[model samples]
Target: MASRLRTGSADMAPPISSGRGPVLWGCALAVLSIALGFGCASTSPARFPSGRALQLNVPYFPQQVGLCGPASLTSVLNYWREETSVEEVARAVYLPQLNGALGIDLTHFAQKKGMQAESYTGSLLDIKDHLARGIPLIAFLNLGGRVFPVGHFVVITGLDEAREEVIVHSGSEANKPIPYQTFIAAWEKTRYWTLQVLPPRPASL
Candidate 1:
């Protein structure tokens, strides 16, 4: 099967878009960057690590234009069994004037859809813990400089200790492997911002 495809439940409804829609298009200045700003990713073949590793099945959506936030969120939402499309996610989160979406908007979108959403400055240990539990996460990376931040969102799926790489659904690729050093260099810019969607709890017996 193609990487982007994933089997899901039949009742998945796209989350309803809400609030003022896009945030105010204020600010006189704007940071310039490429689509999704996945500058840390390279088109090189990943050196599959032989050491400790873990991976989870997550959906993938090729981001159109600067909609990495929507695309990345779609993957995680689907992983939580809340299947949705990038377009549907964009309606709730995309900030056209900025050419991308913000972390706040994405989290709110998930919450409005009745999802258990959380965003924070995540750690490497945190990532491993979540992945071990079969949960994938969304990460915001500043691939630009301190003076000008070129941001992007990618779904993190696994960690390869031997090669020091983190498997992610990035850019136009799914389950792509990026070096830990490279990923962290950009991730640090945003203090390792992470977004997670947890599965609903079981009902009382």
Candidate 2:
């Protein structure tokens, strides 16, 4: 059977014109490298370790137009042992005028729901390590080709070293294996923005 590829939000800006030449591509790559460097510099190596394969039993929530943020959060929260619905999350994270939710909105909403949430920038290796440690991540991906004209949020649930793919719970699909390079390129458009929702720790008394 063909792989089930879930689509993202339709509220993205229009795609870039195809007329741009190699010059634009070169500049974009340079910027991406610099962005990756700056983003990865602050992450501690001890927190993210290399891994071969890692998968977690994360639930799936198919998102409607502009509801990807809430849906992705619902999956992550569910995996963290919280019973949540997309509707409940949407009520807190979704912005009616923008037709979508920002990363900050999602973080704040998660905090209100009693989950510890934080936003950060990291590399693919960092993501792989987090999955290996059983931490599912929510990331902002630029599905817009040529230029980053569109953005979508997804849950990173697993990684396969042999296949060189990252498994994601995207929209309505579970275990979608996106090619490593393909996923990285799209993720780089957003400078590898990630939101981590950690379970609350017991009180230390």
Candidate 3:
């Protein structure tokens, strides 16, 4: 079973007016993972689907047993490596041990495809800018006190321009992808995450 943690109303950060404005939770999650050392090289591989496609076709799996939460990190990783594309990788959450693996996998994939993997430590606004450019961002969040004291992992996947919400795929929770609002709320409490920029795949490679 996954550990559940509670937070008081006082914990919430003042909402930012713009989607690109400051994001407490999202940025926090990005920094903690810290996808470093992995070379950011580009190989020009086969084209992969975009964020919109993955969000619509996200498969539902029953939460696993004996881990932190419902979804199993292993299952998510397998899906990323075998079934899903680079876009889908942004929307997954793995258990503690697998978080590092996820980070490494993403960093490696970005480098392999010639995508730019950047480190955004201070400003989430800059991070969001990268996302707008179709770059995949990784974040590190401290889930100890706010969302769930037990701590957790999550990936930021999609963004809704009209609603100004950030879409995310979180594992250890359930089969469903996390909505923008919910992701923002949970992320604010943990304000430490990293952002990686994934560029468009070259046509000829």
Candidate 4:
């Protein structure tokens, strides 16, 4: 079962549904769980029709501590069939002062490599559109509290309409599932910052 992590400091964490554990409860269930002290129940993840959701076979890289940017970028780049490594990406973009690569730097790095990378949308429909096209996305979020906001980058590998969750590659976790509402809350904190990197365009014939 996934732990009930708190959204305390700057960076992504718990309390929000991880989609791995079934903890969501109706009002009465919440009160009952508290009274019984049994905590939330665990159940199988809700299933969706194939057309409604899907997970791509994107490469996942467990980010080195504090290197979500490089790790996330590597996932998508490799998805496009480009060969790379976390260290290679980090060397190209990581910043020592911030201890993380900046969003702009990530985009620039992709562009320099001849890929079409940019911020496309904050809309869920758009996200689904990209995923349907066999593309993974990089989302920037503030997983921490207001006073100690922690910025984080996660790769969106899939989404399930039935479960309302967005699957991600976060930190050391691969294929971590985050509920849509929970994802939106954290994503909104970062003003819905997201990146999409596509394969380089073919030159005109």
Q: Model 1 clash pairs?
A: none
lDDT by residue for model 1 over 27-59, one digit each (tens)?
112453222211121122333323588888888
Model 4, 26-105: lDDT tens digits are: 10111111111112222233333353668999899988766888899999999998888989988988777666766767
User: What TM-score would each prediction reach against the true structure?
Assistant: 0.74, 0.74, 0.39, 0.74
Q: List the global CA lDDT of all models.
A: 0.67, 0.67, 0.37, 0.67
Q: Is candidate 1 or candidate 4 better by TM-score?
A: 1
Task: Look at candidate 4 and tell me the lDDT of residue 151.
Answer: 74
lDDT of 3 by residue, 105-170 (tens): 444444554554543332234334444444434444444554233334444444444343444545
Model 2, 80-153: lDDT tens digits are 88999999988876776656776777878888888888766656667755766778898877777533345678
Off by over 4 Å in 1: 1-50, 203-205
Better of 2 and 3 by TM-score: 2
Clash tally, candidates in order: 0, 0, 33, 6
**Candidate 3 ranges beyond 4 A from true positions:** 1-119, 122-124, 146-148, 172-185, 195-205
